[model samples]
Target: MKKFTYENITHAKELNIYLEQGNRVLGALGYTDHSGKHTAKVAMTAGKLLKKLGYDDHTVELARIAGYMHDLGNSINRASHAQTGALMAFQFLRSWGAPLEDIAIIISAIGQHDESNGTAVDPVSAALILADKSDVRRSRVRNTVPETFDKHDRVNYAALSSTLHVDVQKRIITLEVELDEGICFLMDYFEIFLQRLLMYKRAAEVLGLRFKMKANGSKIS
Candidate 1:
């Protein structure tokens, strides 16, 4: 079996069509951007997170692949998109001649990346969770009208900047978001993203690291 690299999957033009369609589906559903930009961040962050923790190289690549492909199930439906995307990824990766062992890791990571019904089940899974959940930014907001922004949109739009920092020596991972309180309060962020925060804590635990969140340069949780 040919070894599948992150470059192989990420640069494949055909795979992008699936990602674009999934992103379009999210856009139509009034959700924040799930497009290439978001996936690219997820992919980079996942790989970086694992590498910083000193995971093996192939595992890091698998984490990247899972992150890049994680949201594709949104193309079908938002509900249970994690599981759907995993199945779809399995078929595509298999067709690409990826080994079953590697395919298993990628699919499992994709399946468990969503916070709705997924938890960190492995190193790659933990990396994917931390990477996917911590991605909050104003750029992700797609609503044309500020007056019509929903809770999710408001929270995202309020975010001025976001950075995920991993401190290997301390075994801690922190997600720092700078927000514009004028658009949404810190309370609003917690109200909408509490679940994601809780998931982040658990995911970091799986990686033997502590998870912390800072909003507006202050630790809130």
Candidate 2:
């Protein structure tokens, strides 16, 4: 049997189509960029986190795959996208002859990434949750019209830069964001992202790490 890798999943035509369509759907609804850029960022972030913690290569790769495919179900609908994406990924991975155990881990991580109905079930799932929630930046905001910008747009646009730092020695995962206060207030950001940050905290706890958040150089979590 061939070993399935992140490259295989990333280049899959059907999955790529779904990701593009999902991004389009989100764009039409005035949401942030949920396309290849976002998925790739999540994949890299999850893999890096696991790698820093000394996880085996295969486990880190599984986390990467889960992150890449987590938002594919948004192509169908926003509600319950996690569940739908998990089912879709299972079928696709099974068809690719991936091991059942690997499939289970990937799908579980995908399904548990959303803050609405998600938890840190395992290391992969926890990593996925942290990575997905940490992706906030100006580039994510697609709505260019400041006058018509919604809360999500405002918060994302206000973020001039963002970075996720994992310190293996300290067992700390920190999300540092440089916010443009002229664009949006700090309170506005917390109003929209507090729950997501809380989820990140729980996910970090699952990995025996401390999660911290800093906006404009101030620690908020």
Candidate 3:
């Protein structure tokens, strides 16, 4: 059998439709952008994180695939999307004749990415959690009108810039964010992201690293 790669998944027309439809569904619900751009970023970040931690090339690639397909469940609905996406990815990868071992890892990561009922089950899953939660920026906000901004929208819009730094030697994964205070206070960020921050902490723990966050140049977690 041919070796399946992340490129295969990224270019697959069937998978792309699910990703596109998921973003559209989220947009209709006033959520931040969950489009291809976000998935691509998550994929890159997940791969980088695993690579920095000294994982093998195959494992790193699997992480990238998991990150890219993690949110496809949103195509059906936001609630339980993690579990839904995992099932969808399982069937999709199986159809492509991907190895059962690889499919297991990818599906596990996808199944546990949600904060509601998710934990860091493995390196790939932990990396996916960190990558997904750390994606916050003004560009993610689709609604231009301030009046229509909910807590999620305001917090995301206030994030002028965001970067995730992984230091293998120090064993630290830090999320540095430049938030625009004029749009929303730092407290608002916590109000909306406290669960995600807690999830990040656990995810970092699973990777044997420390999770830290700095918003507006001050460490918040």
Candidate 4:
């Protein structure tokens, strides 16, 4: 087996451009934290999930990198961001000497991250989907003015804290969220995320884990 390291890539310029483009677009919409902060969290969480599940270190590292850049397609457009991001990631990974098989896995995972348009077809894809969708919290938008925060951002603002934990021993994936009603109601968050949560359920099923949720200390399904 060979190893592929993103550190050796000389395409930081292009990667930075992609990141900036996503930041700009999300900012224009007054979204709380769709940029690097959330993406970095997703990337790190994905790697952790794979690592805990006994995946190889190299594969875990690939998950980390894939999660970080999974939303690069949003730089072009939001409608089909995942699909476009897969192509972008594939091209860059190939240039970086990533093996063809690994490249395919990475690209597929990136393309299917959005539950609105994708399904978990592999372990990596399943892990990526769960990691990306689990990130929701009020800390992501504490800086945004209340008056300016839209419903999407307001839901994030209402979430005082959020954590996603995987219990490998119990084979359970749990999402715990603490919310503040002064900012937004819990129903608002569900209204936006129920579909995504359904996708997470499918992703968890692929990993043979039960998906559970606890919001404000109350069990949600």
Highest lDDT against the true fold, candidate: 3
Q: On residues 36-152, what C-alpha lDDT tens digit does candidate 3 reach at each position?
A: 999999999999989989999999999999999999899999999999999999999999999899999999999999999999999999999999988998999999999888888
Residue pair clashes in candidate 1: none
- Residue 190's lDDT within candidate 2 is 84
In candidate 1, position 134 carries an lDDT of: 82
lDDT of 1 at 201: 92
Which TM-score value belongs to model 2? 0.97
Evaluated at residue 82, the lDDT of candidate 3 is 99
RMSD of each: 1.3, 1.3, 1.2, 2.5
Residue pairs clashing, model 3: none
After the best TM-score superposition of candidate 4, give how far the Cα of residue 61 lies from its true spot, in angstroms.
1.7
Per-residue error for 11 in candidate 4, Å, reads: 8.1
* lDDT, model 1, position 91: 90
Better of 3 and 4 by TM-score: 3
Q: Estimate, for each residue in 17-82, the C-alpha lDDT of model 4 and write its tens digit.
A: 887797777667555667668877888898899889888888887788888888888788887989
Runs in model 4 lying further than 4 Å from the true structure: 1-3, 6-11
* Location of the lowest summed lDDT over 10 successive residues in candidate 1: 1-10
> Judged by lDDT relative to the true structure, which candidate is superior, 1 or 3?
3
User: Which model, 2 or 4, shows the larger TM-score?
Assistant: 2
